[model samples]
Target: MSREVAIRVENLSKLYRLGQITTGTLTHDLKRWAAKMQGKEDPFMKVGEENDRTKKGGSDYTWVLKDINFEINKGDTLGIIGKNGAGKSTLLKILSRVTAPTKGEIKIKGRIASLLEVGTGFHPDLSGRENIYMNGAILGMTRHEITRKFDEIVDFAGIEKYVGTPVKRYSSGMYVRLAFAVAAFLEPEILIVDEVLAVGDAEFQRKCMGRLKDVSVNDGRTVIFVSHNMTAMQSLCNRTIMLERGQIKMTGDTDTVINHYLNTYVSTSSTKVWDEHESSGNDYARLRSVKVVDDEGVAISNSFIEEGVNIETTYQCLEEGSKLYVSLVIKNQKDDLIFISSSISEDVWSMNPHPLGTYKTTCKVPGNLLNDITYKVTVFLIRNSTDVVYTAEDIIIIEKTDPGNNRRGLYGKWGGLVRPILDWRTIKL
Candidate 1:
C-alpha cells in the first residue's frame, strides 16, 4: 500500500503591483467594466500590496510568493511559519483559491475550505445559516450534507442565538467562530486555515486544535495551517514549511523546521532601552530600560544552565503619585509559558505610589530550574489591575546554553518545559 498525494504546488509565484495587482483575466476585466456601467463599485477590485517592510521597495512590482514547491500527503497536516512580510498568508491565500498565482499552477485533489481572514468568503448581509449552505454548495456539497452538519456546526461555534444575525454585525471573535465552524464542519477534503484563530480566546484555541487533530487523524483529511503560535503548531503539525521573502526556506519534519525557524530568527538581546521619542508608552509612565543579567548582576545575552539569570527593569514616572507595577512572563522557544514573576507578588511596589522619578526593580531567576533553551520575557506594567500602562511581548531574549545534563542515557535532550531537580528521600525496606 502507498500513500496518496493530496496537494502538489509547483513553482508557484504571485506577482503584485505596489498598491494593487491589476487583473489580467479577460472575464474579470469584462465584469469590472459591466459593474462600472451599472453605476456600482467594481466588485473585482481589491486593495493589497506585497509584504516587504525591510525597506522602501524600489520597483512598483514585487513577487509576493515565488518559486514555491511542496507536496502534502493525504491525512497530513502541514504548518506554515514565517515572520511578517515573509509570505505566509499569501501562500495560504493561493492555496485556498482566494487568489491565483501569476506564473505557476497548484494541483489540488479535492475540495478546499478556507478561513483566510475575518469575514472572508462571507456576505455582509447574509445570515450564518445562508453562508453555511453557500460554502457547502461552493465546495460541491449538497443541501443535505449541509443540513446534516448544521446543528453540529452551530454547537461548536456556540453562537446558536446569533446564527440569525448578519455576520457583518458580529464581533471579531464571533466572525472567526462561524467562519472556522463552516470551514471545518462542511467536510472539505482540504482545509486551509490562516491566523484568524488567534482572535479567539485561549479555551477556544484548544478546542479548535482538538478538532483539527480529529479531522486529520480520524477523518483522513488534509490540512494546511498558518499561525505564529509555535506551541500549537508543534502539537498539530506532522510536517512544517518555512517561507522567507517569498521563497521556501525549509521543508522538513516539525522539530527541525521549528528549531531552524526560531534559531535563525530569534533576536539576541539582554537589554532594550527606549528613547522618549521612540517610547511606546502613554502619559502615565514609560519604559526606560529592561535588561537580563547573570548571577553577578552583569548583563549578558548568553548564559549557562548552572548560572541563574537576574532580570531588571527601569521605568520613569511622568505623573506624580502614580501607581505602577511591573511583571515579567517567561516562555521557552516553543512559546510555552514557564512562569510569571511580578513586582506585586513579591511585595515590592504594590503598596507604594511612586513620585516622579526613575524606579528600577530586579528579580533573580534560579538556575537549574529551566531546560536549556531560548527564553523570552514579556513585560507588563499595570495600574489599578485594569489599566495597562505599557505591555511589550518578547522584549528580551535570554539564550540558555546547557553545558550538559549529566544524565547517563541515550536520550540527548531533556523533555519538559522545566528541568527542576526534585527532592527524593529513600528508606531501606
Candidate 2:
C-alpha cells in the first residue's frame, strides 16, 4: 500500500543578513528587486556561509538552513531534535508560513495549525473564548464548527473559569494550555508544535503528549513535534530527523536518530577532568576529576555487560572538619534515571567529618545488573546529609556492550534498564 505524503520539502534553505536587518543598505534591496524583475536568482544567495555559530565567517549573510529535503507522510508523527542554534525553530516557522524561505519550496497538502510559541494565534486583549473562535476561523473553520468544539476546547484546557478573561492577564502556563487546546481541538489537518509545551506542568505535559499521540494515531492527522525532551520524543514520534548546524544530520526511526544525536552532539566520555581554575564546586570543596573504571582500576569508555563497572570521583575538601559524601546518578539515553547511589553507605566516609584534604570515592556497579546500552553518570557532592555542595550532571558516559559470553545463544535486545541474572528453578507441578 502507498502512503500519502502530507508535506514535502525540496532543497529548502533560509538565509539571514548578519548584524543588521533590511539587507544593510538600499543598494542590496534594489539589486534583489532587479533580480526578481529579471526572473534571475538573488545575487547574494550564494555568498553566505553555513550556520556555524562558533566560527567567524567572512560573508555578511548566513544560511540558517541549507538544502533540506524530506517528506512527511499523512498520519505520521515526526520529531526534530538538535542543539541550541540548529535552525529547528526556523524550519517550523517556515512550515507554518510565519516566514518565507530564501530558496526552494515546500508543498503542504492541508491546513496547518501551529503552537510555535505561547499565545501564538491569540490576541492579548481578546478573551480566551474569543481567541479560540478566532484561531478556528483562521483555520477556515465555519462559525458552527467552531461553536461546536468550543466547550470541548475549554474543558481540555481546564480554563473554563478564565474563558471570559483576557488572555493578556493569563500566566505563561495558562497561555500554553489554551494555545495547545486551541491547536489540538480546532481540527486542522496538520499540527506543528515546538518546545513551548515545556511551560505547562508535568500533568499537563503528559496530557498534551497523550493528545498528540491520539491526534496522529487515532485521528489520522500529521504531527511535527520539536522538543529537547528525548523521552517524550521517543514516546510520540515514529520517525525522527536530527539537525546539526542547520543541516540534516540523520533521518530514520526514533531510537537510532536519537541515539546518534546524543552521541554526536551531546558531549559524553568515560573520563572528565577539570583544571584548577575550571573546577566545579564552591569555596568549601571542588571536584577535580570523574571517570569510569573496571575492576583493574583502568579508566575505560567501554565495558562488558558481564563485568562490574566503577564510577570514580576525586575532589578536594578545602574547609576543615566538613562532613561530605559523593553520590552517583545513572541515566539512559532517554534521560530516565536508572538509579542513584550515595557514598554515605561506606563505613569509612559515611557522615564522617574529615580534615582538609583530597579524597577519592568509587562506586561499583555489579555485573549482570545493567542492560547493554549507553549510560550517563552524574556526580553530586554533598555537605553533611542534606546540603548539596556541587553537582556535575552527565559528567561521564559509558557504553556497556554485550560480549556474547552470557547470551546462551539468545541475541535479542533485552528490555528495561537492568538485565540481571536471577536464579530460577523450573519444575513441573
Candidate 3:
C-alpha cells in the first residue's frame, strides 16, 4: 500500500462452518487432510451445503462472509452500515484485528486504535487515572506522550472528580466517557469505532462525534465508523459501505447509502395487528396493534411538519379492575429519546379507566416544534411503578418536512434536540 492509502483490502473472504467442528487431533485431521490432497478445498466450501436445523437432513456448513473488496485512503472516514445481522460488526472485528480473515489479505500501513467495545481496555481494579495510562500504552503511546495529552484527555472525559477513584465504582456513562476520551486523544493514524456512542447520553454522544470529526479532518487520519444510527452516519462520514449478509451490497457516497438504507427500512411492514393473546414482552398487558393515522383514519408513517399525528394503540386487558396506563416515547433519528410522555405527568391528559376489553389510545404531536428528521415511536403500558404491562420500541416512524419559509434559519444557527420557536421579550434599558 502507498502512503496515501491507509488501508487496502484485496478480495477478502470469510467462511464459517455452521455446526461442525474441525478436530485438531491427528486421526480426524489426517482423514480430512487426505481428502483435501485431491483438487478440492474444504468439503464445507461446496455449494448448497448450508445447515437447516428445521429441516430433516441438511449439511452443517454456511458462509458468514463471501468475497469482499474495498480500500480506505488516508483522512477518509468510511461508515459501515446495515441491518442487524448484516456482517457489519464482523467486518469491523476483522479489521480491528480481533479476528483474522479466513481468506485474502488486508494491508494496513499505520498504528491502529479501535473502540469496538465499551471499556475495552479498562481494568476494574485500576483507578481512572491509571486506566488512562494503561489504555494509552496499549495504543502504543509512551509515558511522555501520555503525559503531554493527560490534561486534554481528562478535560475531554469530564470526570476529573472521579479520576482518582477506582473505575469499578464508575457508572456505565462515566466509563464510556473516560474510555472514549482516551481512545480519541491517543492520536493513532487509524481509528475504528463500532457503536461506541450508543452507551452515553445525548450530550456526550455529541461530544464524542465532534471529536471523531476533528480526528478525521483536523488530524488527517483514517476513520472507520460502524453505526446503526443512520442520521449520525449521514452527517459524519463522507463515504459509506452498506453490507448485507456478509456481502458488500453497495459502496458510495453518504447520501446514496443513507437513502438506500432508509428506503429499504421504510418499505418493510411497520405495524402488526395483535389478537387477545399477543404481548409486547411486558407483564402488564398485551398489545393488539399500533397505528398512526390522521383524522380520516388512514394508516401512514410519513408526515409533514404542519400535519398532526394520531397514534392509535390497542391493548388487551387480561385481568379486571387493574389500572392500565399508556405512555409515548419519541426518539430522534440518532436513536436518542427526545421526548417521553408518561401517565405520571400532570400536564398531559389522564388515562381514562377502561373496562375488560380492547381500548384505543391516541396522542397527537403538534407539528410546529419538530425539525426535518425521522422519529421512532415507542409505547409503554403500565399500572404503577412496579407494573409494566407492555413496552414496544421503534414501533412506528414519523418524518417531518421543512415547511417554513426561512430555510437558512433552520439550517445552521442552532442544531439541537428541539426546534421550538421561543418568544423573546427585549426591553431597552
- TM-scores, all candidates, are 0.66, 0.66, 0.74
C-alpha RMSD between model 2 and the true structure: 7.3
Residue-wise C-alpha lDDT for candidate 1, range 1-429, written one tens digit per residue: 689999999998887766554664555568769988999875633333344766666555577887899999999999999887788888888888778887798899998877676445578788888877776676567899899999998899888998888888888777777777776787889988787667787887888889989999899999898888898899999999999889898999988999999888766687898887875568988888899987676889887777788898888778888888888999876666788988886665663688888888888888877777778898997766667889877889887777774565546777777777688799999
Ranking by lDDT: 2, 1, 3
* Decreasing TM-score order of the candidates: 3, 2, 1
Considering only N, C-alpha and C atoms within 3 Å, which residue pairs clash in candidate 3?
Answer: 274-288, 284-389, 285-389
Q: For candidate 3, write residues 202-229 as lDDT tens digits.
A: 8998998899999999999999999978
Candidate 3 positional error at 57, Å: 12
Alpha-carbon shift of residue 231 in model 3 (angstroms): 3.4
The CA lDDT of each predicted structure is: 0.81, 0.88, 0.76
Clashes of each: 0, 0, 3
lDDT minimum window of 10 residues, candidate 3 = 48-57
